[model samples]
Every structure is written in structure tokens, then in C-alpha cells.
Target: MHESPITGNGDVVKARQAVRVLAQEARLSLVDQTKLVTAASELARNTLSYGGGGTMRASIVTRGTSTGVKVVFSDQGPGIPDLDLALTDGWSSGRGMGLGLSGARRLADEFTLDSAPGKGTTVSVLKWAR
Candidate 1:
């Protein structure tokens, strides 16, 4: 597993690049790699902009003969109060168009989100190799 702090734009780019490398190492297809990278970028940005900086953990996962990448973004900032509204399309709590969370969810094979009013947020996404 590889971990990086998401405190700035540069860190976000590094996180995206790290995930790209992991995706390549996992032998993910070109399409899958792009999808994972895009999702990671969006999530990383959210971590910095909304979460007030956090950490990104990327790991290679396996299940029998299948291989995949799992990335978790965690933060200790103010958490999401309305998960349903946050997941909804075209909603924005800040300056964003509000598609970051929802779009990331659509790109990954599996997605999980945990958050509360004050406990912060944790989002995990996994994309399996084809």
C-alpha cells in the first residue's frame, strides 16, 4: 500500500499519479486505469478543498484470480450532514458543480462513504481488473 497526504494541489496530483502507477502495476486495462485515475483525482480534490486536507491510501487488492486497486480518502474536517443530497447530482456545497462525489461513485466498481456532522468523512473506492 502507498499513502500520501492531500494538503495541496500538488499533493492531489501526486496522489493521482500514485494511483496511476498502482493501476498499471496491477495490470489494469487502459480504460480502467483512466477511470481509476479520474476518480482518484476528483476525490483527492474534494479532500483538499472540502475536507481541509487529508490522506489518501492506495493499495493493491486481490480476490482469488482477480486483482484490483483500492483507494481510501479520509479527512478530519467538517463532515457531510446529508449524504443523500451530497450524492445527488448537480448539488454544490461550495464552489464546485457538485458532481465530484457522485461522479467518482459512478466510475468505480465499488464505492463506500462514511461521514457524519462532526466525525469527518471517509470514502473508499475499488476498481477491479478486467
Candidate 2:
């Protein structure tokens, strides 16, 4: 497993790079790597811009005959009050394009989101190698 912090823009880039490296190590196709990296970048940015600061954990996993990379972004900032709205494609609490969560979900093979009004938020995504 690879773990890193998401405190600034540089950390977001690092997180994206780490996801790319893990995706490559897992033998994912170029397209799959790009998808995962893009998702990771958005989530990492959210962790910094919205979550105030957080951490990213990424790892390569194997199941049966399939291999994939999983990444988790966690933050202890003001959580989403409405998950449905947050997941909407054109909804943005800030000045973003409002496509981060929804776009990441569409790009990832598996997506999980957890957040609350006062608690923190955590987003996890998995992309399998073809």
C-alpha cells in the first residue's frame, strides 16, 4: 500500500502520480491508467479544497484471476450535507465545474462515497486491469 498526504496542489499531483504508478504496476491498460489517474486527481483536489486537508491511500490488489488498483481519499472537513446533491453532475458547492464526484464515479469501476454534515468524507475508487 502507498500512503500520502493531500494538503496542497502538489500533494494532489503526487496522489495522481502514485495512482498512475500503482495502476501500471497492476498491469492495467493505458486507458485504465488514465481513467484511474483522472479520478484520483479530482478526489485529491476535493480532499484539499473542500476537505481542508486529508490523506490518500493507494494499493494494488488481486482477486482470483483479476488484478486492480484501489485508492482511498479521506478528509476531516465539513462533510457533504446532501450526498445526492453532491453526486449530481452539475452541482458544485464551490466554484468547480461540479463534475468531480460524478465524473470520478463514471470513470471508476467501483465507487464508494461516505460523508455527513459534521463528520468527515471518504471516497474510494477501484479500477480493474483488463
Candidate 3:
């Protein structure tokens, strides 16, 4: 298993690179690759745009003797006051199409978000090799 935690503006780019590499190595479908990449990109942007910039971690997970890609994005910003609202389409705290979380959710095979007001936000996603 490999672990990486991204921090700062440039870290997001690195996170994207990591995602691309994992997607390629995992031999995921082109459609799944596109979705995963786009999800990572959007999540990375959210970390920068919302959080004071955050962290992204990637690792190879072997569970039940199966291979998978696991990524986690976290931020220590204002934090999401209403997770339900944040996850809704066309709902945003900024000038976005409100698709960040929603879109990311649509792309990932597994997605989870943990957030609280004044605490911060963390999002995790996983894609499997099929």
C-alpha cells in the first residue's frame, strides 16, 4: 500500500497526476477513467477553493485479496454546515454550478463525505479493478 497526502495549491495537481497513474495501472475502463479523473479534479479544486487548501491521499488497498484504488481529500476550511445541501445539485456556497460534490459522487463507485461546521470536510472515494 502507498500513501500520499497532498497539501497546497500544487498538491492538487500532483493528486490529479496520481489519480491518472492509478487509473492507467488499474486498467479501468475509459469511461470510468474519465469519470474518476474528473471527480478527482473537481474534489481537488474544492479543497483549494473552499478549504485553505487541503490534503489528498492515495493508496493501493488489498481487501478480500482484491485490488483497489482509495483516495481521500480533506480540508480545514469553513467546513460544510449542511452536508445534504452541499451534496445537492445547483447548491453552492460560491460561484459554481454546484456540481462539485454532486458530480464527484456521480463519478465514483464509492463515495463518502464527513464534514461539520467550523471543523472541516473530508471526502473519500474508491474505484476497483474489474
Model 1 TM-score, all chains together: 0.98
Q: Rank candidates by TM-score, best first.
A: 1, 2, 3
Q: Please, what are the lDDT tens digits per residue for candidate 1 over residues 1-130?
A: 9999999889988998999999999999999999999999989999998899999999999999999999999999899999999999998787678988999999999999999988999999999999
lDDT of each: 0.95, 0.94, 0.81
Residue pairs with colliding backbones in model 1 are: none
Q: Whose lDDT is greatest here?
A: 1
RMSD of 3: 1.9
- Which residue pairs collide in model 2, if any? none
Residue 27 error, candidate 3, Å: 2.4
Q: RMSD to the native, candidate 1?
A: 0.6
Better of 2 and 3 by TM-score: 2
Order the candidates by lDDT, highest first: 1, 2, 3
Which residue ranges in model 1 land beyond 4 Å of their true spot? Answer: none
lDDT of 2 by residue, 60-120 (tens): 9888999999999999999999999999999988757999999999999999999998799
